[model samples]
Target chain A: MDFLLHIIIMACLTLFPLLGYNIVFGKGKILHFGQEAQSLMAVYTLWVLVVQFQQPFLLALLASLLTTTMLSLLLAQLSFRLEPDGFGVMSIALHLAVLSIILNWQSVTRGALGIPRIPRGILPSSLERYALVVVLGAIAWYFFLRRLERSSFGRNLVALSEHEWHAESLGISRKKVHTIAFLLAGTGSMISAILFPPYIFLLSPLDYNFQHMIFFVMCAVAGGPGSLRGVTLAIFLIIFLREGLRFMGLPADILGPVQIMSFGLILFVAVCVRRDTLFPKQRTV
Target chain B: MPILSLANIGLTIQGHHILNGVSFDVEEGEVVGLIGPNGSGKTTLFNVLSGFLKPTEGSVTFREDDITHLIPSKRAQLGVGRVFQHFGIFREMTLEDNVRVALEAMPKELRNDMGTMEETVRATLEMATLLSHAKQKAGSLSGGQMRLLEIARTLKSGKELFLLDEPTAGVSPKMTHQVADIIGALKKEKKTVLIIEHDLPFIAQICDRVVVLDVGQVVLSGKPDEVKKSKELQEVYFGADPTT
Candidate 1:
């Protein structure tokens, strides 16, 4: 029962970040460089405040949310202002910067040693308690994203993705829309950060890195870029695949390569076979 | 008062002047035809007027407000609509979804209170004579239907000024009259329209006035008959010898 509960919590942790990516970047586009790093920074920020400063979990959560959102906004502004020559290059640069910051910010993050023994006493120290927390977070996120997806703001995002010039002509500010997307993405990441430490009881820079970022993005893209249902399904499939691979006696060192190969295969097939299904085309009449 | 006025607009592409000091004006409810041979800059003028290109030298005024530097979407918000020579519909989207996007882009204050977005889309589609094709993907539409869909989407946007770049380009001859009828209906509704067309007789039939461009310069501006009869226009447009 406890093991089952652990699986559920792990799935939620994996699912939320992908949801963040789908909402912000739209599918098929590569993941931004520093997404996992930014998520890690949020987690570290909350860990420090809660453990070192003896702050309440809710207050730490709020602070972490503000930190990550502001960081994402800054990155987004820089990315937009520079208008980097290529999406892939910009993503790599951003990710590298985040990794370096977490590695170097010894005072805040304690470098590679990691913050440890994070208190999970607030919620009953049981697997069911963790599952309940996961369920609540997932439900809240779904409701919020669904509401946002239907708003005029969401329409603007869809339009921007379809044709930037056309959307601008319609008076939708692309910069503003992008900034909001970054903020929402940060907020989602923050929620994951809060829910995460309690589950693992340890937080580190290595936990949030390019590999995890790619994993989250793969889930989003494999499910469908702009689809809520697709993203949800993708999360479970990825987790199941990972577990299945492990059960089949794959060495830990080969895990990363295996994931990359499978993702590449699936993405190639998706592009060739069901491009419309994976990245459903939107219409602007 | 003129609804839109362009003064001495010039655009140079790769150091070659495409619109050389071209100027024109349209009043409310007027349908103006811009005619020229290929490479004479009719489409270039359209691009400049619609805020898609910046004129090297000249000004564009809409309702007496200078809008030459505004982006296309801002111009669209200020009541400017453009139809491209090629249909720009989101091919994968259904007809109703296309119109819904335009309507949703309207300022919140101008939006309708219809509880359902489909209702608003249906009404606009009906106005564009596209109700029957509302569920069809825009990509699957016949060329004539696509033209109508473009016009309908523009109409749904609540833009008062229309810049149509070869509205009948690639359209079947049988459907050309249908397109002209839609433009006529827009004019009757007090919308300002500027059209670029190769069909002289069609222009004569629908345009209140015709402007002729030659080698990036305006060679004539008058009633269609007068422009057609001008010796310079006849020689330049048809390459006719002066004696002939």
Candidate 2:
């Protein structure tokens, strides 16, 4: 039962970033690739506040989320002038820059040694209760996103993503919508940043790298970028696949490559078989 | 005063003169057809009026206000709506959502005057003959239906000046008639329109005035019948010698 709860918690953790990516890239069409940067910023901010500054856990969580959101807004504004491909490339570059800073800034981030022994910060100690809380939170987030999809702001995002000039012609401010999307996505990822690291009792720059970024994007695409239910399912499937591989007798080195290969193959087939339904590309009329 | 006036509009990009000395005026409630051959700067002129492109030389006046340097969304807020040659309706959203987005994007005062959002969305879809498909994804709509949806959404957003770029392009004859009827309805509602069209007879059938452009210049402007009968229009469209 505890193991099942652990798997569920892991899926929930994965779901947070996928949901965040969905808001910006899937709906607003910003092509943001800075999820890892945002996550890392939030995690480190929380760690610095709680461990070094001796701030209260709850206060640190809020401050970290606030800091990440502000940085995301700034990043979004910087990338607003770029075309979609440029926007994506710029985000990746920024992510790598942030990663480098985290890795090299030894005095502040403690460098590659990482921060260990984090507190729970108002969360339930029992695994089952924590899983229940996370599951409930995920469910709430799913419904909130669904409601948002039907809201006026949501319509603006959809319109911008579908046809930018048309949306602008209708008085939908592309920059405003995209900036808000970035802010919302960053806040979404902050949940996992707050919960996941403490659950594992570690905050490491190595954990939030390009590979994890790619994993989140792959899960988002496989689930269908705009569909919350699809993303939820995709996360579980990918998580189960990874966890299942761990149960096998393969060596660690072999297991890593095999897992990545399986993800690529599954994503390729999903895209091929469900191309029309997966992302629902706007057909030019 | 004219509802829209373009005074000596010129646009040069990367040393290429796309438009030059293109001047015209559209009066209140008038449906003006801007007819020109391919590469004749009709769409570029529309882009300038819609605030998508800035004319390097001249100014655009809408309702006595100069909007030459306004951003597209600000221009939209000032009641300049454009229907693209390529349809602008959000295809991934439902038909209702396509309209709802346009309505909701408007300024609060304008949006409020339109009554409830639900009713407005329904009415807008109904105007486009698309109420039945309100819940359906707009991508499933035919090309003609999408054009009508875009025009109807624009109209319902309370735009005073409509810039329609080839509303009949890619539309069937039956849908063409429907588009014409929608423009006629806009005319009755006292909305001003500047339309770019390739179909001469369609222009004659609907437009009160015609402005013919060729190679970035306005070659002729008059009543539809007069412009249709003018020799310079023949020379511009057919490349016939004016003397002949």
Candidate 3:
């Protein structure tokens, strides 16, 4: 049962943010790499609010989500019409800039030394007590995305993905659909960020880098685009694969490389099975 | 009065003139057919009017509204519907879904009622005789059926003006007749239509006016019989000298 909780907790962590990116990805086929940036940016905001200003927890949480949403919308504005390749490049660049600021801002972020024991938890329990609650939150998020997938808004996203000109000609606004997707994606990242501190006790710049970005993207892609169930399966499978590796007690040096290599291997097999189209192309961003 | 008009429209790309001073007017409820040989700029004009391209030298006005700067979606929302030469049906979706997408953009009063939306979708599909295939994915249809689906989508999009670009490009004679019947139905409701077609008889049966373009110029415009009798149209279409 404890082992089950561990898997449930880790998989649940990735699912909320995955759904956020999946909204745009399912219809647009653009794998946004900046979600990690938004989450880390949220973390920085939460720490400053709770630690620096000594504000109440709820206010800090609200501010953090709002900041991430705005940042996401700003990114969307910059690369609105770019194709998948250009959008990917732009997202990675933006993420790096945010990561750099968080790493170098010693006065505000405490630099690479890390922030310790910032207050976390909404329920009464032990420090690592809310894995089941997190699982519930993930389930709620999954059902929400599933509902969205069948709604008019969801249909428009899919139509936009299939053919932009036709969708627009039928009166679907590309800007409106994309804006909504990005905003939702930002909110998804914030949920994961807010749920993060309770388990991670220590915060470091390393947590806000390209590695997490890849993990976030892979969590969505390996599930298959435009599929809610596919994503659900992918989340647990990836978490299990990585955690199972840790449980085996490999040497620390090879553990990191091996986890990454295993992903590459699965992705390679996926490509061979589905053809070199792991990420399908979108006409425009 | 003219519902949609273009004045002095010119498109120059990389120093080559794609369309040169093309002017025309489509009056309310009038069906106009634009015919041109390859490279004569029919599709370019469609692209320009549909908000896919901005002309270098002129403007587009719809219902007295200057819409030269509106994007494609804005133009669509303002009652301009297009059926592409390559068809615009979302092939992966069911036929019902395709029609539903167009009707999904219908005015709030009609769309808010589930029963009305269903009836609207059903009626639109039945017009093209595609009601039986409503549940199937469009990609599985034959080219002719796909063309019918495209027409059905454009029919229910709630747009007052229809741009039918080659409605019978790659279909059988029977399917072509069905398309003509569909256009006749639209006319009965008093919707304006502009068709880009190659079939002269088809144009005669539907269009009230014919505009023949050649090498980026409107060389002839008249009733179908008058345009067909003109030497200039024959010369442009056949590449033969008018006097000869």
Candidate 4:
């Protein structure tokens, strides 16, 4: 039960961010590489509110989300072109800049030393608490994704994603849709920052690394990137690869190296074998 | 009244002049054919009129409103539907969904809600003789079907001005008739249309008057018969336009 709960928690945590990426990449046709960086920055916002200002949990979460939203707006404003490559580079540049701040802000973020004792849940059993959060988050994310898929906004996004020139001729505002998608990505990262950090009760500058950004990319890639079910399957597949080996009685030392190796190997294989399925369509037929 | 008027539109990109001081106008409910040689800036003029390109000089007035600086999407929302030489339908989506996408591009109040949206989609699909293929992905369509889809989309998109770039390009003679019929239907519905075509017969059949462009300037403006009789038009088509 505990093992299942743990996997589900990870799944739920992954669900929102992946959904967010789907909005930006799947619909908006952006390959945003800075999603995980935004998540780290969101944690820093939470840290400032909860630790330094000693704000209440809900208040701190709101403030953190606000910061993430503003960052998202800045990213969209700076790089929201119809071209995917330029937009992607702008998002990555924003992430790298945030990383610089994280590495240098010793007084606020504790720089290399890291911050500890992040406030934990009120409930005694961490498993039950995590399970509760996961279930609620899953329901919310599911409804949100479904609503997005059917709305007028979704139709406009589909038009732009498939044919920008045609969509523009029809009067679909590319900037408005892309802006909303980037903002949603930011909100997803904010949710991740709020949910995951408290569980570990620690914060470190190392957590804000590019590897984490790559992790999000890997998950998005492994899943169909634009597909909801594919993303869900990918989140589960990743959790299974990491934790399933543990349950199979593998020792930790060898297991860690093996998991890392498989991560790279799987990425390569997925790209080679599932390249068509992994990315958006480039051709007409 | 002229629904669309372009006054001395000039466009230069990277020091190369694509068009220079080209002017034309289409009265309400008129179907105008824009005929020119391969590189005589026909499509570029279409782009400028549809807001894809901002002219360095002159202005575009749609319904007497200057829209020279409006972006492509804004022009679309304001009822300027353009069909490309190549098919512009979202091939990955279902045929009904393709129409739905165009419908969604219009103002919310202008489009039918969920209750009647499907009915509206069916009506547009029927116009293209594609009602039965509503569930089929547009990518699976034949070349003729794709062209028809483009026309259906343009008609339903609530655009007052329609700029069709080589609508019958690469289509068979039968499909060309169907496309011409669709354009005729749009004209009957009183939409102002500016078509760029190389097929002289199709232009004579469908257009009220024909405009000939040579070297990015208007060389002839009259009926297709009168323009076809011009020595200058024959020379322009047979001769190279400009070095640029």
Candidate 5:
């Protein structure tokens, strides 16, 4: 039961960030740099308020959301203004910037030492409670994303992805659409952040670095970038594989290497075998 | 009134002059054909008119407003619609969704209050004679169907000024007539159209007047018969005299 609960928690943790990034940057055939940074900032924001300021859960969540959103908007403006050849580069730069901030500002982040003993109300002692929390979180996220995808705004994002020039020609402002996509991504990351501390009982700079960025990207890629189901399945498979490998007597030191190798292999295979299925080309109208 | 005008427009890319001092005007309710050989700046002029490329010199005015520096979308907002040489229909989306997107992109005031996506899509498809394939993914459509889909989307935009680049380029001969019919429909609606066509017969059938371009300059502008008779125009298009 404990093992199952752990798997569920890990799955949700992995799935949320992958889905969040894919929801916005994924659509544009261009990735944005700030998604991972925004996620890390969200975690830090919540950690600071809940641990330092001793804020209530609801207030901390709200504050984290607001800060992350503002940061995302700022990053979008900066990243979009300068021409980065692709979203992958932008994401790497932003992730490094956040890492630098977290590392340098030891007072706020406690740096690599991490914030331990994170209080998990009601669910910390029981596997059942943890499972319930995971189920509830997944439901909330699924519905929220579904609502957005079905809305008028969602259609516009898909349009922008399909043909940004055509969308602009039709009078839809690219900047506004891109900003909205970033905001949605930020919101998803913040919600995930609030849920994360309770599961792991810690927040660290290592939690939001390039390694995790690649993990999230792999989940999105494996699941299929433009598809929700693909991303969800990818998150589950990746987490399952990681835990399975760890259980097979692999040392902690080699875990990161294993993850990188497996992710690369899977992504390469997926791209080569099912290029059309995984990353179906979109025509511009 | 002349809905759109281009004066002495010139465009150079990577040290190659693609369009040089080419100019023309399209009045409201007129369907003007821009005919030329391959690499004769017909499509380049369309690109400039649609605001996809900035002219190195001269100006573009629409509805008496100078829109020389306006971006593509801004020009689209002011009633400029462009159909590319390659069909630009979103392949992943359904035909209905494609038209709906165009309609939704229009300013709120311009959209029909009573029109749902299904209704707008159906209407546009009917106009283009493609109602049967409304639910099919646009990428799955044949070249002719894709062209029809593109024209349907343009019409759904409700824009008066249309820039169609090689509307029948890849389409079958049978589908060419269908495209011609759609252009006729645009004429009946009193829309201003600038068509770039290599098919002389297609241009001759629909165009009120034709402009011929060679090496990025307008070598002739007159009725189709008059332009067809020009020795230089024939030489530019056919490379030699038929008598020879």
Candidate 6:
């Protein structure tokens, strides 16, 4: 039961970035491949402020949110200036650049060794209470995204995704909508970054690598882009499925590869099965 | 002063001149027809006026504001609306939502002047005669109906200048008449329209004046009847000589 609770907590933690990604890439049609960088920067900023500068927890969290949002906005600006294909390549490049900085900034980040023993700020330190807070936050975030999807702004986003030039001719500013999307995407990761470091009691470079970025993208794609319910269900499904593999009696070294393989397999099947949903289209006769 | 002025517009892309020295003026409430041979740069001129493609030389002045280098969205905000030759309707959205999106995107002052959102959407759909299909996705709409929906949506989008590219293209005769009636109504409302079309009779029926293009240049411009009977137009459409 404790193990099951742990999986649930982790799944909810993962929802933060996934929901953020859906708003930008799924709804806005921005090929933002820098999800990993946003998440890494959020946590790193928090760590630098709380651990190194000795700031208040809330203050550090606010600063982390602002910093990450700025990073996302900068990336959005670059994405705007390039074609879709170029933007995709640029986002990946930016993600790698951020990873390189985190990996090599040994003096501040402590490099690959990572910072351990992160303190739980202002929240209940008990595992059960922390789980409750995280779970509640996830539920609220899901509804928040749903509300956003239904708002006038959200409707504008859907219209833009369907046909960008048409939406523009209606006076919808593509740049404005896309900028807000990146802001929200960054905020989603900030929530996770705030909750995650305290929960894991460590901030490691490995946690914010390209593999985790792919996990977020896979969840968004396999679950069905632009559907909050689909993405949320996918998060829980992938997390539980990964945990379920633990009882397979596989060796520890091989287990990690097997888990990633399962993700790819699930993604493949989901793409095949939900082709219509994966790509939003007009109904056919 | 004319509501829209295109002065010496020239667009050269990759060493190919799409539009050269294309100049015209559209006064307020004027429904001008832009007719040309298939590759005579009619659509390219519309693209430049709508800010889709920037002209290499010359300027676009709309309501006295020089918008030559402005982006498409900014042009839209300044009351320049375009109905594409290809349908621009958001197919996955409901008919009501299609109109609603445009209304919602209008400038705040204009949106406010137009009553509530729900009323505006209904009225816009009513203009297109698609109010009954307000709940239906626009993809379910027939081709002619889609054109009507897009035109109606643009009509109510608070735009002072409308650039319509082949509005009647691929539409049925009955739907084409309905489209003509909509343009008639737009003129009555004193809205400025520059329409690109191949349907000469339809253009003659609605347009007060016509501009003819041949090989990226305005070969003729005059009253519809005069343009229809011109030797240059005959030569442009058919290689027929004036003696024949």
Q: Please give the CA lDDT of all the candidate structures.
A: 0.76, 0.86, 0.82, 0.81, 0.79, 0.88
Q: Which scores better on DockQ, 1 or 4?
A: 4
Kindly report which residue stretches of model 1 are placed more than 4 angstroms away from their true locations once superposed: A27-34, A52-59, A75-85, A274-285, B13-16, B112-119, B231-243
Model 6: clashing residue pairs?
A: none
Model 4 C-alpha lDDT per residue in residues A144-171, reported as the tens digit of each score: 8778878878877777887777778888
Worst 10 residues of 4 chain A by lDDT: A276-285
- What would the per-residue lDDT of candidate 6 be over residues A1-285, giving only the tens digit for each residue? 778788889999999988999998777767788988898889999987889778888798888888898898898899889987798889888889998998899888888988888888687887788889999999999999899888878989988888787888888898898888988999888998888888888989898888887888788888788879988889998889888899889999999999999888887887788777554453311
Question: Which pairs clash inside model 5?
Answer: A31-A87, A33-A90, A33-A91, A169-B73, A223-A230, A284-B88, A285-B88
* Chain A accuracy of model 4 expressed as TM-score: 0.88
Which parts of model 2 are misplaced by more than 4 Å?
A: A274-285, B241-243
The best-first sequence of candidates by TM-score reads: 6, 2, 3, 4, 5, 1
DockQ of 4: 0.61
Error of 1 at B178 (Å): 2.4
Q: For candidate 5, what is the DockQ-based docking class?
A: acceptable
In order of DockQ, best first, we have: 2, 4, 3, 6, 5, 1
Report the number of the highest-lDDT candidate. 6
What is the per-residue lDDT of model 5 for residues B7-31, given as tens digits with 9 covering 90 to 100? 8999999999998997788889998
- Could you give candidate 5's per-residue lDDT for residues A143-197 as a string of tens digits? 7887877666777777777766666666667777778777878877876786777
**Residue-level lDDT tens digits of model 4 in B1-244:** 6889999999999998899999988998999999988889998998888887899999999988899999988888777889888788887788988898888778776674434777778889999999989999998999889999988888887788889989998898999999999998898999889999999989999999999997789988998888877777777887633333
Off by over 4 Å in 5: A53-63, A78-87, A120-127, A277-285, B238-244
Instruction: For model 3, name the residue pairs that clash.
Output: none
lDDT of 3 by residue, B31-149 (tens): 99999898899988998999988899989999999999999888887889999888787876888888887887665654665467788889888887889988998879988898988
DockQ of each: 0.41, 0.68, 0.56, 0.61, 0.46, 0.54
Question: What class would a CAPRI assessor give candidate 4's docking?
Answer: medium
Write model 6 residue lDDT over B32-130, tens digit each, in one string: 999989999998888788777899999999999999999888899899999988898888789988888888888888988998889888888898998
Top-scoring candidate (TM-score): 6
Candidate 3 stretches with Cα past 4 Å from truth are A127-129, A275-285, B109-115, B241-243
